[model samples]
Target chain A: MSTPSSEQEVHEHGVTEAVISYPQFLWKALGVATDGNALFYVWMTALTAVWLVGINAFAHQIVQGQGLTAMTDHVSWGMYIGNFTFAVGLAAGAVMMVIPAYLYHDEDMHDVVIVGEILAIAAVAVALAFVNVDIGRIDRLWHIIPFIGRFNFPVSMLTWDIIVLPGYFLINLHVVGYLLYMRFLGRKPNPKWYIPVVLLSIVWAVSIHTVTAFLYSGLGGRPFWNSAILAPRFVVSAFVSGPAFIVLALQIVRRFSDFYVGHKPIVTLINILRITAVVNLFLVGAEVFTEFYTGGSHVAAAEYLYFGLHGKNALVPWIWTAVVCNVVAAGIFLTVDPRKNLWIIDVACVMTLFGLWVEKGLGLIVPGFVPSTLHEVVEYLPNALEWKISLGIWALGLIIFTLGLKIAVAVFTGTMHVDAAHDAGEV
Target chain B: MSDPSRRTMLKGAGATLGAAAFARAVAPITEWTNDLSVEGFLQKHYKELTVEDMSAVLARIERETEEQYGAKVSVEDVRPTPGVQFAYALNLSVCIGCRRCAKACHEENNHDRATNNSYIRVLEMTNGSLNLEHGTVTYDHAVPAPGKFYMPVQCHQCDNAPCVRVCPVEATWKESDGIVVVDYDWCIGCRYCEAACPYHARRFNWSKPEIPADEINPDQAYLSNRIRPQGVMEKCTFCLHRTRRGKLPACLEACPTGARVFGNLADPDSEIRWVLENKRVFVLKEDLGTQPRFFYFFDE
Candidate 1:
């Protein structure tokens, strides 16, 4: 709430000049997040219920052992690791907005770029949660701590992941937190404070996803993942899924709130998706050609994924579904214009999101181990408990994203400034 | 507009409910943690342990094994002998696919009785084909069924071990005697090593291993046959508990067909060396350049 004079000032200058201390800013942000409309309450409640169920299931997993999941020694890394890989791409994909907004100095993108950064933070949190749940010894997690634990640095790709994923999370958090705090204080954010970090985040985003791809590709034992093009495919497909998610998110934000998100940013995202989706398809085609054409013992896993190996084709349908979804989505993005046919863009975006989820999550990870290294065919599908844990992680991420957006919207719309409560005589 | 005291009471109630829910959500982790000891949680890596630290660790393990499995076990920290690098030579010509080697590994390593877990997997391949991709591990009819030759595979303990390289915590490493060993206490059980292993030699403890009291192997090495905690990776250490003490590996000793030969590679007169010199010998997946200490040979 604000008095007439302060409200006029906000209308004229887009902000009040009054600044608050850091702790006060955080306290006010928390207040803004907690205080929301009825829809916010319903959404929060739903997410909380799912998250609690997931937590209980995870606790059950911990008590019972990882054996409760469908994972075996043959397919040791399963849905948990699959979801982790996909979420890392989502986090990295959030940098797409950053590239246009910060690097190219696009004004429309700059206004909505904070939304992408917030999504990155939430995505990284989800990625870390999946990793935590997947590990066998959650209690012994301290063993990977760099100083105290015997961290096998410079050798283990996982250790590299441990470094980059958290590093990306912190970088995005710092950028988003600083910008929001400054906005809440009604002050113009200094370019020097966040510019370098923003630039670093763009590079760091690519590194996080690349590191994740390398985690699979670096393993020589699994020939399905031992390709040089895996990292490229990861980055390119991230571009597809990342922009698709942002497009859907931005539409939701525009519909729900009074924040002035123009069609320009949505068009920008669609344009990115158009190119990346095709490139992603090209990479897939290239990889498929390389695998099938070579046709050796190394092709066993790919054969199992695409055309069922030895009467055990659990993943064949899944891969084909991804291919169809991706091809159809790319076609829509290439032909349909978001300016006239906005609903069609939404459809295409959802399709790509599902397509990339299947492609990156199950289609990629499962095949790498289906025909085990010793040529034994052992198919894996995530059981009910694994699905519960994954859904819970998604719910937790949504909770973080929703709360973050609520606070950001309040600050961006000039409703929760430093001196507004004081001016309204409510302090 | 609302009453302040009533609002405070409501806030307190909400906080209490939240705490209860959080505690319930984390109950499994807490219950799991109850089995973990502070000393065990803080135990140093195998390479970092001092003589005193190792002795204390061994004592702690023995105590824990007694408490958990109800089996009185002697856990020893066996050091590798100098100038003695172990190599295994299996005579493919004599192997009949009885899977006695796998059974021997199960008993010798104190594997879970439910899974019948073992470090070795014996594949029955068609007579003319050397491709492991064509091999099958689940054949049930009989010993070396007609037109099939048996090949038993286990950890190669490679000079360039991918499992060792990929471990995020350095929990597994190759020792001086050309044997790869895992410090089960230190492994975070990410199973990255399991995925990196081409041999499918590594096994994971899906749950607490079940062994009857009388059947439990009492003679254990801290890094070898001792019962591993749930959710860690274990593999063949070439029976280092016995081999380091100048004894044969249980798998080699149990071979009724004399199919397996083991000895110090450094000793020129060793039987393994003689097999390598006299017979046509090869390592599995040699093109991967794992430089395996384990070899297979066939007589003409």
Candidate 2:
């Protein structure tokens, strides 16, 4: 809030100076979509309406209290913290864009990268919203403020998180603002602005998830998450899952629209996915070796998550399925076939994204929280209401993302008007 | 960097006022008391407060708890009798599988009756292996069912505390008087100290603690036994609220077998000193270099 007056995208990023404001431009773009042919727009609109209805149904339930949900004593965190952790990992994905564009100096990606930063902001906001809704004591969020109703800072990691996350959100906001300004103005962004910001972002990204990881690992009794490898594992999961998601999203965009008119741009994004996915696979492989190799109490945790420890974790097959899919996604991308077919690239993206989503979103949490601290097995099943709420929120994200992109696309690719049929002649 | 959180600053202020008012109120009574060492001094932020500050902080402990916990609770100073050092020695040999000490600790600390959380755990250990390594302290099942010898576990009130070392924010620390206490509000709940503690003595409240109004301990200490928040870490404070005021811990009083003994290690003539002088007293995990105040012995 202390930051200076907002400058409109100051460069090719948005340099109309007296130019079209984003909210105005966004509405105008949405107006065109109501008239134009981006079917993603139609799905976006439909999902938004469905989300609203679901929220009404669940709001009544959540308002009456968490007593509304099926959360018994056993599954205390349940889908609430589940979705929160998932979104946090996705938000950390902003680094995928920030790291490549600024740190590694990949100038070609400069066009699409800030989208990731913007996505992170939305992810964090959504993560907070979900956590708020889950806690039911949504109004007490201000309690974290020191001197306000007793914010016990020294005693809580969640308290430390209250500080780190908002700070991360501010840093990401500033960096994206400058980058968008440079794009709008058609001027070089101050390297002074982006370079330091990127390094800070790199550490910050790792912290978001490491702190998230610490939230679980700090619980000395939860053997499933007690491994020292947890923080690094969280980082690997994020980079992989984040990029995999980008691929899925881009493919969805290309299928119904003309954005990727050529194979090269899409290919480049795929290669980025492949390299990251393969690196992710390698790390996961190392995780397996280290966990199973130790061969003791930790073995139960691994078995519980993957192969079924003492017949408790029914989610093991799902986790293993995720592992296999990720490994296969790496293989297909590495092969010559997917490289040759845009269709296959799209398919691999869909598949790998699903795998990573399942692994990070579902895999990270349920395993650790299972068999409450007292070693009693508590079942964690997402009821229809839980699914509906998550679906609604996810729809909310797609709607927000769609409108954001609708505005971003119009702003970034201003008036090219090259046969609005979009790639009628190209591959 | 000089700016502490407003919460910390105000708490610091509250603590200051409480101390000054206390010294004036009890100046005459405290005048010739040699136990008036820095142990009775003003408390420090685990980081900034020095030994002298601790001495200043302790002088003010005449239970203004009515202002804090909103109840009229008695505060008394309990010390070991002359020259007898107080150390807790549990007779694992005679420790029946009963969890009376755990129950006593819960009632003593004014824990929520429904939650029934306790600071002490009577671990049911299998004999002859001498390895508590595989023993579980979390069993809620009825005790002494089969081949099990019960061994109670609680805060060791360690002389060499790991929990105090890794705390980056200085929320938890060892008191000069051989007790460990946490500045509940200041604790960041990073739980680094929780993980650092090998004994798993620490616990975190994931939601607001709900103790029935009638059941709540009217006498509360801000850093000692007050109900903690949804996220901050908490653990056994050795009943510092009682110990500082010359009182025995509720667990010591409740151990039906007289297994638990509390006294000043500084007092050589205390019952705990006699236990040490006459019995084979041993501590848990001395190999890890944690000098635990809680000891175990077998009375033949």
Candidate 3:
């Protein structure tokens, strides 16, 4: 559990900030992404390949129309919408690190919070891409803009989503973008530029997921989503999955590059994950009990989700798997000291991420359509086309995250740091 | 002149290959442009378009429909008249599960042939049960098989319609005459309205809807049914094309048992108003307060 000390110790021992030249910093960082070992090239090429495949599939979809996918009249939304929901949660979950770092002034989380912010930007971008692809008419997207096309603001939750998601993306981009640019220039970041935005982003973070939850919850027809507890459940699960993702991502950053992510931040993150996972589990139980105990028309979706309805049990096994994974992951964190054994932390993090992905994605969306309003049980499963498109979107997000992380790591490690005293100052 | 280095040759080759690949990728778009004109692409939003613009858009749609489906169809822009509120009533006791009304609507509205995307779904329920949870929409048996009753459902055109409220682009809305319509061209095909409707009334055009030239409904309205393009949401407009023009809805006219009734609810002497006044009329999911203009009554 002892902190791994090396470059961090030296920096702390003497506050001798490495002076960097802005132009040289850019050149070095650019070179780092381009001039890499074979493995890095392979990784980048693989993602690009997948991304290109996805682009091909999406182009085919646009030409052929959405009919190529399994989405039917019964199930209007398929994999694309489900992935959008999960990505929004990932974006909102960035607030978990932000709240601790900025509000409580947790020094351990201060440096790591920017990593989460970058993640938020990537997640939001992917979520928006999903919307653009999923929609029947991308050409008509301008209709959602105010004054140009009649933007149904305030009333429509989807419009709220259109506003908040991009708004959040901009906020995170500004905060992370400014902080990194300042770091690259070897200058101190002014709090005035980012402080107010950081606070505003915290609220925007919670609102994005809450508004998304309302997109479902506000539906008068779908009883499965029309619950008072839905919003809170979304927020809680988001906190668990978002931080768990960052915890694993930080480990990758530490391993792959010279980024010095201390053990203290990981420990703090595990503590946060443990608490949120437990609360999320409790909320799941609460929803299950309320649905099963009441035994009303609304319970039709729950019955289909947990047990089979009309001999169709498509989601039954999936929901059960989610329940087991989340409960066991939370249990592991509670009992085992992940700080002592890093394996437990890694395993727990993967389990919670997978568990929440299923719980929120398919487990939330598909069942709402099952036992349709007229009470018809037509199960939905995403076809191959949807998977290809989804994989492409994910690959695109990862590519962005990888490149951003590369530049960020170079800046943080002072590999781009120059003898500013001799160079042509901060460009 | 020296031969190009390997790196230089690869760069040139890559650029050439990229251009070829880009051409291949854009081929479909070029073909689509042939069918969908640049004028169609630049068509203004339904609310923004002038009378001249709307007429031009309608002409383009008619021409395109003729070109694609090979049917000379009339696509008219039907406007709601003031002081005329539309309403519908279904007699649960008399409705046979024949689904003839649904079939007639399919043809009248020009629904897709492959999926038979009808807005109306007739649910057969066991007697003594009003619980929708137990209703079976896919009952393949004969009409009103012994112990079951039929209830055909469609857009209720609620005064405070959730579907209209949830449309992010205002693509769908309730008209002054109480008929909720979707501007097929304006809709982005997001399906938020589909998710919002409790009745599961809204249907999305998942792909380009196919219909034979002979089977295509020549009488089409812009707001009601004009063979919606791929990737937009459509629902029952209470047959606005017909009803707003002082004609009975196709479903009502096609119903054999006189179970379906359509009238201007704004008229005090209308059959729908009479049903509401005399019969024990009720709406589905009344507790949600959608206040649907469509009513159901047991023919006592």
- What TM-score would every model get versus the actual structure? 0.95, 0.69, 0.93
Residue-wise lDDT of candidate 2 within B1-300, one digit each (tens)?
234475456546745754564455335333223322343222334345566654444334433234334555543323323433335777777677678888877876766455577777666677765565456666677766577777777778888786775555456776667767776545544444554565657665543455655666655565567565444567887776766667888777777777677787677778877887888888776776788888888787
Give the top-scoring candidate (lDDT): 1
Best by DockQ: 1
Interface RMSD of each: 1.3, 16.3, 1.7
On lDDT, the stronger of 2 and 3 is 3
TM-score of chain B of 1: 0.96
Specify the CAPRI tier of model 3.
medium
Best-fitting candidate, measured by TM-score? 1
Per-residue accuracy of model 2 over A1-427 as CA lDDT, tens digit each? 3224333322322333314344443345545433334365357557755676557545544334454555544455566667777778788876776676666676655556656776777777767666665653333344346554344465556666666677788887777656554444344677887778768987888888888777677655456666677777777667766766665665555565444433343455666676777877777777778878887655555666787644676677778788778877777777745445756666666677678667666576666655444333555666666777777777677666665555455545653112223223222
How good is the docking of model 2, as DockQ?
0.04
- Docking level for model 2: incorrect
lDDT by residue (A1-427, candidate 3, tens digit) is 3456765675453243333344665666666665455587679778876777787788888877888888877888878988898999999998999999999999989987878998999999999999988998877788788888888888988989988999999999999877886776566888998999999999999999999999999887888999989999999999998999999999999888878899888888888987999999999999999999999777989999999898999988888888888998999878778667878878888988889988999899998898787788888988888998899999999988888888788777776554556433222
Model 1 TM-score relative to the real fold: 0.95
In candidate 3 the C-alpha lDDT for residue A210 amounts to: 95
Q: Candidate 1 vs. truth: CA RMSD?
A: 4.7
Report clash pairs, candidate 3: A221-B198
User: Model 3 lDDT vs. the true structure?
Assistant: 0.86
